[model samples]
Target: MKRLIPLLLLAAVPALAAPVAAPHVAARSFEQLAKPLPLPYAEGADADAAVAAAKARARQAHKLLLIDLGGNWCLDCRLLAGTIELPDLNGWVKRHYEVVTVDVGRFDKNGQIPAHYGITGRLAGVPAVLVVDPRTDRLVNKGHETALSDARSLTPQALADWLARWV
Candidate 1:
């Protein structure tokens, strides 16, 4: 009876834990992604204004603010941007986040964006994703900002999974 009680308690543990949501991805592989991945960064646009607008929208919509800091020249940044725009993932992202892209040209421009979230010094790389909570205006994923810096190495589903984690 004692052994059976322990087994029953062990079984209950799984039920008590939170369930992880599966990533929504349309593409099965990276090769299947659309040709000439999108150049999302707008060097000519005002990044500060864009971020402020996004934050306001996020607060009003009760969604998280997703700041995508990268340059058009970075292949990994483009890959990450392309993956996020995938049909299935795009819808999910739109539902949960107000996204803004800031062009950090060769890590020289838009230094204030990351600094606003207390990320000082040299960035790890391009495609630094900042997930901010609209209510508090705090960075949710602090240390993991550069997690997708090497987007080329991740599968489409893996990229979606990474974004889903913040949601």
Candidate 2:
């Protein structure tokens, strides 16, 4: 038993020492940020259609559209949204991309889109961005790939740059 303990401890060392990189941040030029991303999406209240577009785009070009899913009263959603609507970012977003704000009942008293979209977690705390490709409706990214789902770190400009890279 004592001999085995030494081997087991050695094996665990690698797992504990893995490098931890800080969350990714994009630093693109302001001028580039202002330009339209050149990807277009069809719009309606139909989330299925939206997901379908995601699938199609994913298959064809490996692109994902940013989906801000939240109710009106979620504070983080509020912060993320308020940041996006700031004049500089807002103007850029208005010209360069398609934004769909889904009311998933976090802030709203009785919204149904959250269930329709198969969401199973916090509705308001979610700055839940579904980067879905339109060609095949595949999901490319959801805010973060961390150990805990509580790791979404996106600024409107940083998010805009991330989306641009895929498109």
Candidate 3:
């Protein structure tokens, strides 16, 4: 029984030692990838009212409203924010969408914002993005809620391309 115990343990070692798969992050140049920073989701504010204000601005600007739904604790969410803030893309984003970061605190805060856009709660994960046409009060990208949730896996160029597609 002692010999059998050693063999059993040895057999289990490989399973335990197997490497976990790393998250898929697309390659990017240092200049292309913005440095990660703290998420800038406003705390204790009515998300709906904020979106409404953004919608009004979008209407006047003849642009779309981008409602970014996520929280400060979400790494992917922060990554997306940084990627979008890159100088080249940041200007493009400003020209195209009135961006608003709605903090869904650990999925406990402002969940209704997604529901308002027909996303229920979340699409795939935190950092769900919705592009809304202020002119029509309609969701432009309905099924692509999780498009930017994997910002770590996407290069800055890829993120820019995605944003450009909507415009």
Compared with the true structure, all predictions reach lDDT values of 0.88, 0.45, 0.76
Model 3 CA deviation exceeding 4 Å by range: 1-36
Q: Report residue 141 deviation for candidate 1 (angstroms).
A: 0.3
lDDT of 2 by residue, 15-126 (tens): 3444332223333332323333212222235655554464454445433355666544444455455545545555555433345655555343223434434544444355
lDDT of 1 by residue, 135-160 (tens): 88999898999999988888999988
Put down candidate 3 lDDT per residue, 1-167, tens digits, no spaces: 98999888977864344433322234364344555565678878789899989989999998889999888888778777877766666777787789988988778888888887677744568788888888878887788878888777767777777776566
Local error of candidate 1 at residue 49 (angstroms): 0.5
Q: Give the Å shift of residue 127 in candidate 2.
A: 2.0
Q: Which one is best on TM-score? A: 1
Order the numbered candidates by TM-score, best leading. Answer: 1, 3, 2
lDDT of 3: 0.76
